[model samples]
Target: MGVGGNFWDLLKPYGHKEGFDFLRNKRVAVDLSFWIVQHENAIKTHVRKPHLRLTFFRTINLFSKFGAFPVFVVDGKPSPLKSQARTARYFRSSGIELASLPVPEEGASAERNSLFSTYVQECVELVQLLGMPVLKARGEAEALCAQLNSEGHVDACLTADSDAFLFGAKCIIKCFCPNSKEPFECYNMSDIEAGLGLKRRHLIAISLLVGNDHDMNGVRGIGLDTALHFVKAFSEDDILNRLCEIGKGNASQFQINIKSEDNIEMDGNSPHKKQLHCSFCGHPGSKRDHMKFSCGYCAKKDDDEGCLRKPEDFKCDCFSCGMNRRQKEQKRLENWHTKICQKIAEEPNFPKDEIIDMYLCNDNGYFSANDGPHTVWGKPNIEMLIDFLNFHQHWDPSYIRRMMFPMMSTIFLRDMASTPAESLLFGQYEFDSLERVKMRYGYQFYVVKWKRAGGNIAFKVPSKESGTQDVAVELDETVNLLDDCDVPEIHQDDECSFLLTDENMDLVGAAFPAEVKRFWQEQELKDLKKRKNSASKSQENESPASSSARSIQLNITEFYTSTKVKHQPKQEESSKNNDSGDSNMKRNESSSSNLPKSVRRRLLFD
Candidate 1:
């Protein structure tokens, strides 16, 4: 379904080869989309959420064992317009959580929000374990990372999708299990452009014109080649104008036929002349209107209609059941966006330029238009906010707490039941639960500053420092001392003098809460006692089955092709069963027909 399978296809020959284990040792920044797809909780849909199925511990262990590093980046909520487009796509495909209401009465649909939140936590923990930085940018983090690379922040971006190409990444290396024999494929931007016959910038434009399956459905008739032609031939204004015109002629049968035919021949030429009917209206098309259908028969009355017979009009198959669904959804999102924008406006210390700079506008996508005064006094002095809670070190609980209070107050306003920390507590019902929300929304004090500078600033601030400093400080403050030295009774000859200055050990001690300390002490005693225990009992404990590998029973109720699919059954006896059931292995190859025609043609021919 992606990159004409050129990416996966390239790795096939190298699978089972030596040196592939190097992948585990390499630093790979996993994108949010990949995580969504691996999740077992969510039902499969046309637009896959890659956050599912990924085990936080397994990923961490994989990276740790191989001496590799991984940075997991979560995609932020998209623009209101983009989100609306996403919701509509889910509605059409019947595979997303768009059906859930703000207040649900009952069923799994209602549980989707909880499930989604839980899965995000799992993803965050996996990323956290690797000690790699995670970013929560407004758009896709892979794209943001690409932006970072352009500014020379990192060596390269590691992801699975070709869409990263659209974000201007100079290089993209496909990620695979280090244990797998597959050779990691590395694609350069210039090579990709040459192979695809489109420049890197044009890739974004083509993606926009053809539609991104993750965000929105591309125009039905536009394929890769046509989309490429579109970016080359038309300016941004021309593309928008074409969209408006095509929408107007949607009803004409001739136009729909032409588009349908265009979908078939992706090599840039058609055997038959392009039809002038609107696909949506089933009426005559107009070059002036770009064949968009407003009224089913309006375009037909024009001169173009004289050459063709009147097309029969049929009611939309799902119209009655779906009446006003689009409008209702649109209204809901518009209200949400307006409220958010207003809240941003009202924040006493809002940094307009920073927030504005967070998003980059291109012809491919339009960001929310800015309103309110472009200038405001100390209106949320970003620097003051930075200092009020020091960001020089790794972000700690208190820092998150303080930041949340102001951020929630500014964004949620009266809608929130309490302070950001309190409301989040209310939302999650626990303090530990704050990690995922923070991972997703927490402004890595560093990433935030980098974004604010819009590439004008340089210097990569280590996020780990911001995260660990307070714990280190607290530990240092709590250590017992007498005149800057340990008491004589406690300071035995064996007690190393170096322990007093070991900042890292002190920091670790500080990070351990009371119960944790007791548990560690007990574990140490257990180790001392282990040598005296009976050999038989130790043997029992050392059995392979007793290893502490977390086993998860994922009951995947997948809905596909109008049917439900469940994974291999789990029975007590099945614990020893190694039968790899073919029936349970349902990796449906998603059709890539929606991609650009040239790409499609390449796939079809390949």
Candidate 2:
């Protein structure tokens, strides 16, 4: 659909996956029609007017979650040359016949075209209501997207078109998948040039040779690989001109190898000459000599039948055979190159000047030197947005409000950053407190909670079952949304919390410096108090234990299962030798005689 040569595939290897934060604070040019068609294809199978739903949600996510200021570009008049390609594509996709009507509403293409264009208008309205800019292109939307990117009016172009590179786009997000952690297949032209060794003109040369949406019949025999090889031979400065020259039967000006077809023969005084081989033995020398006496290579004493006769598919691995094969391949390629050049010469106007001009020209009718369109973001009209979504999408007013809450909060924060004032969020809820910081994938967020002011609950309505009405004592932020999504849900509480992670730390710090300062101050003071208490407790526990100077220390000086020791007195007591040794002996003898029972007999025995 882009450039009929599978151009995106050629550039696929140079692409990288980028996270949502990659577009933070960047101005991106979006091919609005491309996104619409892509979404319609995916969702139209089941959902009614799927383009509406997809465009609505995807725009919200891109603006709020990705934090990008998007300029949506809608298509203008298509190139006259793309009519056939466009019609053919439609037929293939819809399985329609060639007999067609030119009137606006006569055919399937017409009906689809009318419906698609109407939806595109609706999307443009939605984008405007959402505060993003929309620009109409003079030619194709992608061309204008590329123009905006190349002119530095935008940081990147968001489109899946392969020809965006051909149109001089520096960087392109090949696709957008909002749910993925890394939601972009981003490609840079510098990487492609380095990886493929191909420049813009080289790409142009390739598209011109193989085909493009503008010219499906480029050359009869040219293909991607052959065209790639052909284009790389010439530098960018002369590639398009060389193509023009070849188109005008001036291919002889370019160097082409002279093609010759001849079979290999072992002849005298030739560079490729080799010794003749015995056909039956597959070795050096002639068969006649081998028949008379076994050749030296096949001369075996046990049994010799001249190398047991050559196998039917036997191939000689001699040096001459290798040289022969290389020469043949070289000649074949030369022949191929010659035929391709002839085909180029045969086509009338081989390189269409309009197609080349279409790609090479940088003026896309939307850019200017002094007065380009303003790239600044504007304030969204919430009332208008709710009405618009409700009318077109059949969505509830509550659902629309909840979905767009993120965008509104972002706008509010941005305003707070500029004004540096204490203001209610979206003029309805006031900042309650700063919840703890939450981090995901190495990015930090200020979890800020907000509470709706009393008597100002815009979300609260009359009770469903009340004859008159009941007092609204409390309010809940929860609501029933039309679709389940990753948009941060509002919990059932008077207060709601948000992970304000889209902004840089410096911006948020500038916006709410007092809150940030207070949080850090509290954290530091709390940490100090904890440390102080812990130190005091540790000291209190150590004081009583440290008061005692002597410690009853026990030591196990030996290793054994069990041991019994006789009781003994200390050294001080044992060393005391009484001076009255006779007295001590008489005391001990008297105590022993006083021991009872058969005292007389015991004394006699003793």
Candidate 3:
């Protein structure tokens, strides 16, 4: 979807795995359309309305798991060049023979937008309900995402598009992998520049030489490696300009530093002459001389008879041969570069100005430095979200809330951290107690219990002056249908009974420091008490028996050392059965006939 010729592979070396909290408290711009369409395309056949499902879960994970404030950007009007490229891509992927396939009419070419628009719209709606900000790009979604990042409106762009680098993204998260310990495959422009010496313009130039989303076929003969080699020859500032010049058949003026091995260069006046070599060893000197005094390469201990046999793909290593080889390679590359530049020159539009403009243009006015794109992450519309998912996904409100709890709790904890106070979680559940501390993936969390908030409590008192009963008037407990199946059951005499849930340890420490400290102190006391009790028990066992004159402590096993000795209980039972003239089986059968049918069935199963 970005630069072709396996551009991501070229950048793979620079990408690094980032932890779940890498984007904590940072604003990230997401290529909303690509995020949905690319993923849904993979599992769309097996998963129904995967876009909506993915969007829902992804938003929750990006927000709650990574703690990133995600701003989703949908595509506005795509550029005409992009439209043409997309059409071509669709045709190529349709599995139809291009020559046999009828040339378009609108009906012939399947528009990619038409296929994914409905789903993308549904995703956009779901994201909005989740309370993330959504923006429309002036052209491509990654363009706006990159703009937001470049302008410092967002900390990073969440996109897989390699062209996001060309579009001037400082940092990009390619995507998240659910199965990975470090989920985010993050790329920093600084790392790329430090490692590959490629800046934004250099990447743009590579995209021009290789290929990109908008320009599918770059230079006919050039690929990622060729583009990298060609791009490195020029400075970042003039890289794009050089590409334009090369596309105009002016590459001859561009000086290329093809470093010769050991700084060797052949002068026309001193052309490298082919050297004589030993036929057996493929090294310098005549074969006759080598047979008498072994060649340097062949003699390991200066006593070897024949030269070590040359390998199947061996080449002569003489100085003259190496020099000549370099000369030929230099000439070949010069010719190859010339041919590639000619191919660029032959193309209708060399370095497509629109694409260069698209990448370089920092502000498309839709998102700008003046009044930057809105990246504010708002409070989620819970009710709206419930209704939306219920209608589109057929998910029960209870299920939605359960799924939404992580995101909801995260937001709640943040508020509590800033203004420490007693509050209901999600305005429905109240914090009960901290159950225990749990660890996962090297992260500490507090297992906290939450119970349904009692609307029956927290009521205004009746006025005493009015002669009304002194008790405060109360409202009946609000029975919510959504919570009927999900709400924790309260047992007799226990007001706030509920299951424990894992809460971020850091958030809990900040929001409820006193409680956490108290919990630790109590745990320490309990552990100390346990240790003291065990120590006392051990001392009691080890101490001499009180008031015992001569107590014998004998080991029964030492007294009875014989192995394989059986007890006489079986023989005694046979004698008893013989005396009674009735078997134990008959007695059991009589008792079973009196027992219940259910018990008999249970016995059969047992």
- Top TM-score: which candidate number? 3
Which segments of candidate 1 are over 4 A away from where they belong? 1-26, 39-53, 95-112, 175-180, 213-215, 229-606
Which residue ranges in model 2 land beyond 4 Å of their true spot? Answer: 45-48, 93-112, 177-180, 256-333, 456-488, 491-506, 524-606
Instruction: Quote model 2's TM-score.
Output: 0.70
Angstrom error of the Cα, residue 498, model 2: value is: 9.2
Q: List the residue pairs that clash in candidate 3.
A: none
Score every model by TM-score: 0.34, 0.70, 0.74
User: Which is better, 2 or 3, measured by lDDT?
Assistant: 3
Query: What is the descending TM-score order?
Result: 3, 2, 1
Superior by TM-score: candidate 1 or candidate 3: 3
**Candidate 1 lDDT tens digits, 60-157:** 33332232345556666554434455456556678656556133233212112456666666556434432345655456556665654454444456
Task: In model 3, state the lDDT of residue 593.
Answer: 90
